[model samples]
Target: MEPNLILTALFLISAAFTVVTAEYVRPQPRKDLQFPWDPKPSSQPQQVHISLAGDKHMRVTWVTGDRSAPSIVEYGTSSGKYSSVTQGESTSYSYLMYKSGLIHHTIIGPLEHGTVYFYRCGGQGPEFQLKTPAAQFPITFAVAGDLGQTGWTKSTLDHIDRCLYDVHLLPGDLSYADYVQSRWDTFGELVQPLASARPWMVTQGNHEKESIPFFKDGFESYNSRWKMPYEESGSSSNLYYSFEVAGAHIIMLGSYTDYDEDSDQYRWLKADLSKVDRHKTPWLLVLFHVPWYNSNKAHQGEGDSMMAAIEPLLYAASVDIMFAGHVHAYERSKRVNSGKSDTCGAVHITIGDGGNREGLAQRYIHPSPEWSVFREASFGHGELKIVNSTHAFWTWHRNDDDEPVRSDQFWMTSLVSSGCVAERRHELRKILISP
Candidate 1:
């Protein structure tokens, strides 16, 4: 053979060797016997979960490495076949150094009032799921905060794993993504076990404030991977939205915004609260990333900074209850004037023990402050069951030593009914107002 022919033959042999080696390194698994929880790489989704959209909507968010396929949600009356299909786009998150798998999401529109919908989410590509209840009116859900990636998180999840709530409300500080991106995966995996059965609603937290590259992508991977109910309720943005669930008007506030009473958020809150007549949605529950009445030293009065701008609106509108997270521990308050009086004020609960890296909060306002009605430095999670419009059962499960137990619990009652306050101005709602 000529010299050029010999060279071509050598090149072909090397190419064949490279191809064989690559195939051996990335062997394909048998489709019939694949495990969903096996950390091994595959086209299957791991963090499969859902978030309730107020009353009649559900947002499904998941992740997959391959983007060649669509984000499809197959649904019907049962889990056998997905007769209904909704497709979404899959996008990747660009980190400071590398890129991860594509995140997919699908938001189902207004579902029936109390129907059980069996469904699985993933594109025509990969999927998994169990039957779940659609959003319903007057449904009871558990609101938790400060959940991160930790052993306590595992226990908390296991404890809550039995509660089988209709929804999981995360006020903030989800995966503690402020420092690293890996924890986000841990948060995702554990939550999949429960959120797949129910919806896991969320608001932004300080931890999600990563560098420009991360934020520029809109926390691209995180936001794209999860779906929220923004459009259905006429919410201008996902960061802020209001949905009607059961007999309550739920508004999710984003504190990381310009909350100067004159800002856009303040105006929108006012408008939203003003229309919440006691008849339409009898109870008004407002949730945000931070707390307004926490007594912990780290975030003492941190929420006070925005009270002047946002408090008056929520107070004026008589938001029935306010839930938040930021501090690492759990704290409840005495129903004061602004939050003290019986006729008005929302019952504030700071149940941040959802599981995080921080151990616990040991300081209070006074030498230890009197504002903290109850505080504990244990690994735990909170469960809120709305018994009715006037009452809710708040229970905290302390997952100490990885053993789940009901550490502290209480009954949170609301006096924001029509018979209590006559108008926008009430003394109880005024007591806590900055004097």
Candidate 2:
């Protein structure tokens, strides 16, 4: 062969090698930041957050270094104006070598919905404000899960703050404290900006279960600090509960707790579903930590047993949507039942990609299942805009984009309005009347 021909052949081989070796590289995971306790007055309130308590009420929770600080909140419609005062209870706990600060939980209001209230915790600290969720349709929910104290978590929270969401729903794995109690305090402070403004309704995840053989039980820290309206919902444990907001019924399930057919959660859920007035609420939703219909390789089949025990109940009730976490990625499934697509079934969405320090679940199972709609391994949050009783919009926002990108979105019709609820009930009646 000629020398020029040999040179051209060698160049072609080099280009081929380069092309084969070039692969799409994902961005590096962000490092976890240590939010140490700043030296301030012992009585000063920190880690201020809020949650829904009951009808027309909000629960204000905060931490104080001083165990004796007053559990009181002063608030009014305007800042620096004293109008209403309420007193609440305070408690503290110890785990291993760590002793937590005084945690105060106060129930404030008969508050007017869609109105902002300025309040001060422990009768001190700078005034903080919170906006109550609207009482009618056209409300929004910011959904994210597995949010740890990392740079990625900050980005997700920042993105959520830009959205005009009425409430925040977390499926689980909140702090990732993993038995280190101080991280819980830091995590609380980290989410204060967002949680203090709007109600943060969350469920328990595996990370929140810091149980030892004999030393401690699971969720001792979590149950004490992050209280939900379990009592009002007739739920025996905080790990699982239900709450209503803005014409919607939201059920937060506990993946870490017993969810068998004979378990307390199962019984409560049955009663709760039976009590739901479709005409009044119009939309029903459920959330938990482990996904029943994930396409990701991580945490595969962890939710099978729970799903087996409860999926039929959800299907019969015609739940509009279900959210789950613990997969460290994002996945959305078509309306599904028993691993098959069904129009009357609930839409399962796995959005565990809220930027935990453990990183994303980057691998997905090949030959994607038919039920899986869209799946991605990116750190981000989701927005659910329930526009009306019948129709709603859902969007997934990716953090890699310079601007908020609607990477995935679709319009969803409520089961009650779509006549699916009636169809499901008829099917259930047929089964009950038959064998």
Candidate 3:
């Protein structure tokens, strides 16, 4: 037998061994999924939001129907006072027969931590304020995904607003308007109230991949809007990025992108994980759109391939927790590594309960999996409050009642040891374990 042919056969067999028993493939979208979104051109800025530029910087983004309108912001630390003016650029997207509104982005920097700043865009818009976090531990983040424009989405936003979170971690499926580009504007409007006041960190989901008739690659709209800190993190693609807020280094992965061991995303993830100073950021939280350990029947096996490709890196780095969306329900797993329980392993949590056009994922396949510790089917959000470098609190809130109710709650602690010591901590000092 030829050596080259033998190597090819071995590669094929290895690839086949990695595939899940159940085939998971996304169906093509319908052809006529677009809806009319034409509106009178307005000069006023709208759909305004902010994202992290760096530890001491915040990037402000907005949209306008009129491309000729000025893209500028007047901001300062005091209310109703303009100390500085910054100018930005605007971009527009045309897909099929629809042209999107002009999107603008500006980065404001040299900011003081733990201080409030008021700003107005387009020079004459209403004033809004946001606070930057201190350069230390104890940052709170509200996370969810699969958010679309619906009554349930409104309720979830209201609850998130009341929580007064400092930052938002969205894994994927930001807007379910995959087919209709216009729906992205409505989703931007729905989340602007909260997103404008805090950094809404995001990564691309499968829904964000809308096929452009003329282009071979998708996610044109997602790439144009919702720009993340990919460049700052030494990544060339916005589909995946990493950033630090307070004492945690958050790694955002892209499920729709390639994840082979030799892919760019894999190489970048390897470099990013290698540079994390665990002493400074004790909590390592990884997030993406699909779940590698979800028990729900809706998006089962969607993250299996992704998990198999990258789970080893996470376990080697001692990642504390993993967050995901797309299942349309909430499921939390016990500390797991390589298909079994291990104390040093990262705890994977699926929080796709954020209300969207598609309702809750209610059905569970008979005989629940052993890894899932808590599971709930409802429309809501989750909160992670890092109290210090050592301990952090996690809670899932259900939006069925007048006020947010805690569907599940637990505390996560960073283990000091790597091997058997972490396993012993899981058994001996399991403080505030949730059933």
1-435: candidate 1 lDDT, tens digit per residue? 643344334432111111212111221111111125556455677678887654556777777766664677887666567668887666676665546676777776556756667776664434455433433343667777877766566667777777767667888777764534555665677678787877777877776654354244344444554556766556566677777766667888887766776666766666665556666666778888788877667576678777667775666666777888887667776554343444456667787777666556644555444445666555567777666667767777766556666766777655555554457656434543433
Q: State the weakest 10-residue window (summed lDDT) of model 1.
A: 15-24
> Please, what is the TM-score per model?
0.81, 0.92, 0.86
| TM-score-based ranking | 2, 3, 1
Residue 117 error, candidate 1, Å: 2.4
Q: What is candidate 3's lDDT per residue for 306-390, written digit by digit as tens?
A: 8988897677677888999988879999999998888888889998877766566666765777888988777779999988878
Residue 97's lDDT within candidate 1 is 53
Model 1 segments more than 4 A misplaced: 1-42, 123-138, 213-221, 337-343, 367-371, 425-435
Better of 2 and 3 by TM-score: 2
Error of 2 at 253 (Å): 0.5
Query: What's model 1's lDDT at 92?
Result: 73
Stretches of candidate 2 above 4 Å error?
Answer: 1-25, 426-435
**Which residue pairs clash within candidate 2?**
none
Taking all chains together, the TM-score of candidate 2 against the true structure is 0.92
lDDT of 2 at 36: 64
For model 3 the TM-score comes to 0.86
- TM-score of candidate 1 on Cα atoms, chains taken together: 0.81
Top lDDT model = 2
